[model samples]
Target: MEIIGFIAATLTTAAFLPQVYKTWKTKDVSALSLPMLLMFFVGVFIWLIYGYYKNSPSMIVANAITLCSAFLLIYFKIKYAKTP
Candidate 1:
């Protein structure tokens, strides 16, 4: 079951990478909401902490990756807002 959980986490976590890299490179954040990004980042952070406290590797990996991906989205939102 750990393998299945890892695969699921890996796929979902990886699924966001290409989009994040593309958006970061293009600096097109016009469609993103800062509040939404902030909320997600905070939520993911809490989940990461909870995962750590619970000693669940699956939760830890998934939440950590998600936090980073979400951070990228938030970063793009701020960094791209000034772009014309």
Candidate 2:
């Protein structure tokens, strides 16, 4: 069960990398919603805290990396937002 959890976490976490890379390369945030990224970052941060409390290595590692990715996306979204 733990192995399954780790595998799931790994796959889901890895899935986010492509978006981050695309955003980095394209600097195209027109399709990225600020509200969605903010919500995701908050959720991931909460999960990270919960992971620490539960001492779940898989959760901790997955959320930690995801938090970074989400944060990067949010940063990019803001940094590259077009001026009205």
Task: Report the number of the highest-TM-score candidate.
Answer: 2
lDDT of 2 by residue, 1-84 (tens): 678769989999999999999999999999999999999999999999998999788999999999999999999999999997
- Model 1's TM-score against the true structure: 0.85
Q: Which 10-residue span in candidate 1 carries the lowest summed lDDT?
A: 75-84
TM-score of 2: 0.92
Which stretches in model 2 have alpha-carbon errors above 4 Å? none
Q: Which ten residues in a row have the lowest lDDT in candidate 2?
A: 1-10
Model 1, 1-84: lDDT tens digits are 677768988998999898898898888888788998898899989988997898788989998889889988987788779746
The per-model lDDT (C-alpha) reads: 0.86, 0.94
| All candidates: TM-score | 0.85, 0.92
- Runs of candidate 1 with Cα error greater than 4 angstroms are none
